[model samples]
Target: MNRKTLALSAVIGLLAPVLAGCGGSDGGSDGGEAIVVGTTDQYVATEDGPAPLDPAFAYDTGSWNVLRQTIQTLMHVPRGGGAPVPEAASKCGFTDRENESYRCTLREGLKFSGGDPVTVEDVKYSIQRVLDIKDPSGISGLLSNIDTMETNGDYEIVFHLKAPDATFPYKLSTPPAGIVSQKLYEPNKLRDGFEVNGSGPYSFKAEVKGDTVVKAIFTKNPDYKGDLKLRNSKVELRPFKDADDMGKALDSGDIDVMTRAMTPEQVHSMVDNPKEGVQLTEMPGLEIRYLGFDTEAPTAKEKAVRQAMAYTIDRGKLITKVYGGMAEPLYSLIPSSVATHTNSFFNKYGDANPAKAAKLLEEAGITTPVKLTLNYTTDHYGEATAKEFETIREQLNGSRLFDVSIKGAEWSVFRPKQTKREYAVYGMGWFPDFPDPDTYIGPFLDKDNFLNTPYNNPTLRNQLIPQSRREADRSAASKTFAKIQDIIAEDVPVLPLWQGKQYVAARDDITGVEWAVNSSAELLLWELRKGTGTGS
Candidate 1:
């Protein structure tokens, strides 16, 4: 999946000094009280079933946040962000020089939250089920490389790949690869509802209204067997309808920390006029917002139409006017932070030019003021999305070459429709599954891509991606990735907009705010605790 950073002084320093002396305390270590964290993220049931909590279908950040706490993968990204390290497994590595065969040995005495032994069979079953179900909206693509799985004795599991895949271990580190009890989950069907049963740092019980998760209360999983140490005994995750509500909860101390969907205005308020006992923690992020196209749709079917709109979109204007300069204008699917990134779009289109847009349309025999619709989710991204689309509507309309109408839907409705390619052009944001350049490009360009778009190029999907995956050294495949980015810019199936930095607004009494959310944008709820300091 193409997932979803910024500079320090220009962004963070403008916000506030990085809070110092904010350390976790032992006071709350004895199960003192539940630490309530507020987020504007919503988890809803989809056509794939009410399996948002199931590792096979928990593709989004909201679901993964809860899963990361309760579910244990064989390998996981470290708290401070680095290469994957063993979590449930004692050790894991490629068993061959070809990077095709991989093996992992489970840690001794590993058990599920239900207190059942976590055998190698459970590990094989968990991954096999994801491939069996293959939910279009789920993360089956990450595990598509697996040709077969073999078990050795009771503690070891081996994955045989379809081809050489150096990134397989990173894929295993994500929540989608989280091990589950085979008894509780079906072999070919997703386990429904909000109940999560895994061996991780915490165990959770959730409250749901309709299909949306309203609240989730996580207690320390005493049966948990993992490398992570829980800083707080309990964490209650409260979901808000919007940033305003979440911010109010933080201001009134209804929640100790507010994360995920804080608006630019709310962040500015916190930065300029700090709350008495609250502080904003900024960290490097790879989250990105972009527009996806249904290549088969009437107006969008034409390559020139897609190219014309790309020429007319002023990303800098969108970032400055809508985001208040809190985000960077992204020109490639690969964000600037990735080593293989290139400014391919900027190199091709230069800047937003209505004249260039008009010329392309005229050459393609298309009429002026081409009519089209732009779709976006109302609640999932943030409150500013409405204004962000409005800014885009104005930009496209201002060009006098296109007639654009913007449509908004709640995520539950938006996600299914977008995946079905119901909209001619839709907006979506990505939080990377792993820290790699492939995570940015592969998901959108591959044949079994998550976007469900029809713009497939053999060179990108069949050739370059596999070529890049074959090389054990990721940096050595930069030229291949550059070619991949060039094809994406030319195809215009998706247009890059802006990349954002992560922010967590927390009360000074809350520590580990910086480490609470990892580089991949997954919430490490176990990292947060009640602090005894004045500074954040």
Candidate 2:
């Protein structure tokens, strides 16, 4: 992937005001069998925007939400949650035990939403273009393993890998690997504008663009040959300023569903009050929030100092005081539900021991009252982050071994700066790109990891990760994942804080709320249906 340029921050700064101007009437059909869903996120030149629907350029949740429904991939996480399954292909798997070579054959009679034939050349070109454009912040991390691509016939394609990558197929199932219409997109650059062309369950229609996008329209693709059958004829996506606005819209019957941006307080209120016409679906916990540090920073370079900070922080207190117990403490980088997850950090640090932390600092010859700055985003990470970091500061200061100061940035600015490693220590959250332990461990260990924190553990980066990727037997591979967690705990580059439950609030009458969130934590709009009160 190409290195990201800092210009993205300026581009994102313009988005909020541009989107704030998008206020207008719902402009959607509410009386009939229409379903409207919204998020507070703005459409922008960055990954968050709802426009520029081409898969190569879109990476953030907003773009991924639209792409997951409108574009077809080789495989996908089924609605209601399960393993990745074939979507456009009849089948795909490795033909070699070394995991270096793979092959797939397209389902017969496959065609794009625009009626173009889904040929092997189209598949080959779509994959190659992602590498060619190489948007620094794009999902190219998912495709970095490719060595070469070859095709035998119109329907057959083979992938020759640079290394044995067991999670390669999982990568194919994500938005970054979305197959495109070769006839439409330029092979060397991202397609311009919001006119999307794909072969998924839905097809793109006119976007309601203002200074910001007030709404986006989509209709079922009559030509789509994938296994998924749409329950709704059209999908209308709107954006609200926050969850409170979205809750008001849902209560006022202005929209049928609300997917994200609800604070824990708002969610709890809904659970207790039981809004007459609304139903809240509390999804299984799959998200992780954490603190990451720059290993190369002078303050953090000392291993004992980092470990001291880890042992001193009280995770239980953070969950209760900052999150109000809306989240559970996370002991490992991988969530506990996954088989590969291991509580290495918890095993090493236990609950919290201030005395042990102080001793560690003393042994390392570090002076008392070390200074560190904690950074977080005010808006994107939710309003609770201020409290979360303040709680962290209190926990550290209580030990009397360190002095902590807190700083806040809007997500647009924060992301770029963090990626550039401007902050010595910072808070971040992760939503899985695909459902696998490799998704959690591989990126951070990669030499060009997304964290951009200065770290290069040759054993984890060059040996353990690639070794784990070579195992076709996932059960056997999990042992290597356990080893990885132990190494991460020893290093303490990132301290896992807590895991949060996914929440979706919809009208009580809306069917399929249970199926809306897949195992990967992606929102599947196709699974949603208007209530039986609205005629089918």
Candidate 3:
């Protein structure tokens, strides 16, 4: 029975655009076949674009994985659950100094999507080239700890380190740090993300410029020896301009899966809409929406003031009411899912207490009209955000403890602005760099942290961060983050808000959905199939 032919009479198009199941027009032809997965996301493959297909680039660049599917990193961290498995490299390891001194032994005879043999030179060139681009885009920041690399043999390569970065292996598994072929890479014109070449399960297929992309087709790499999460070779990705359109196709039987986070309002409506053919799976994410205070010198110098801010607002209600149960109130910078998590802040601040906040503020010489402004990203996170900020405003304004002003900026402006320590008080959300406590605590605590907004803590940078990474054992690093989390709670440079969950809508026919602690958690397209309308 063709999956597409499975009762067309039952397929009734909605009044508005809704999503349909997989295998509609393009995935498989067998077992009630064909899966057409489309995202409402718009992508740019031009030089000025983020270059969607580069593996060592564009993971959480957000809204650009249309081409990311066609590239392969050394490993695939499906839903970032546990340890990563091999993808491009057969087996890779650090000879010493974390991933600082690392080597990957190539599989016997792997070839690129263009059919060039996977070799040690490609691995070395890929890592080295990203450094040439010098885009911290995140990987450059993580790999900055590396000093140098050179091929040891035809099948092996080794890297040198600037520091003892234990997360090096894990970092290599990151998509932003993926390997690329050197043979096809043009050093003179490396900025072109559109002309992607890689050794992943899927190839570029057909990128209809900007509006829509049709992945020509995909198949298993004949020489693949690396352990990866999925093996479906015939992966195809279609591009739709709007999620509503995508949803219409989803409801109308075109695409197979959808997982961008929606406001709690949307989620509730989804829960209530009673669309008979579709299924919704909501998973708690690790991203926490909170306010970041630059407490380095004059801006956020007083501990009592920070604590008063924390005690004045209700986080639980904020998550449930502002987020509509789409998020869980978080007490720690590190969520419970990560290692070395403790409820130091929760233990301290039980609930919202305006009376206590007033006294604390009074003690700090801060008055009711302590004018603090908040900043937010207009388009980056999700729909609940604006309402979330409004809720915070009402909470503080009602308390007579604050005269709050809010500012909103797009991610383009916000990213560099926050990095320059431009905001006095701002709103930001962070998806973990990795699933560990270090990822939760380290980057924020580092004096030169990516957030760029400094927290006035020299010991955190000079002592905690440097000491933790220098520790040879990774577990030792976890313990360091525990202390770091406590310091964060004590100082309150950034308040702990809510841990966002990953949500997705897939047709009953689609299978294989998972998420990990890392940032790029989504269906790999390389590993999905249309079931007999049965859940995967």
Alpha-carbon TM-score of each model against the true structure: 0.94, 0.88, 0.80
Best by TM-score: 1
Model 1 spans with C-alpha error above 4 angstroms: 1-31, 46-49, 533-536
Best by lDDT: 1
For every candidate, C-alpha RMSD to the true structure in Å: 4.7, 9.4, 7.5
| Sliding window of 10 residues with minimal summed lDDT for model 3 | 8-17
Compared with the true structure, what per-residue lDDT tens digits does model 1 show for residues 335-378?
87777888999999877988988999999899989999999999
Candidate scoring better on TM-score of 1 and 2: 1
Backbone clash pairs for candidate 1 read 3-432, 4-286, 4-430, 4-431, 4-432
Better of 1 and 3 by lDDT: 1
Candidate models: Cα lDDT each: 0.83, 0.75, 0.61
Error of 3 at 228 (Å): 3.5
Encode model 2's per-residue lDDT on 1-536: one tens digit a residue.
Answer: 21111110101110010011111222222244558886766554444332356677665666678888878888876543345678998889899989999898888787887677888888888888887876645357678789899999899999999999877888888887778887788887777556777888888764555434577777878888876757777878887767778878887989887777678787778766666667777655567888888988887788888899889988998899877746889998987767778899999998789899989899888998999999998766567778889999999988889998999987666777787778888998877787667878766668556686678888998899999888876778878888999999999989999987666777766666556664345767776777543222
Q: On residues 1-536, what C-alpha lDDT tens digit does candidate 3 reach at each position?
A: 11121111111111101113332223332352445655433344533334545544453534335434555666544332445556666777777644457677777677776677877777777777766765434435656666877786778777788767666666676555665667676443354445665666555555565433444344444544445434244554564543555567767776666656444654566677656666666554567667888776454667787788888888877776777666677888877555556776777776799898898888777766677877887656755567788888888888888888777876556655765667877888776655445666656665335565546578786777766766656566666776777888888978988776666676765655332112333445545665543332
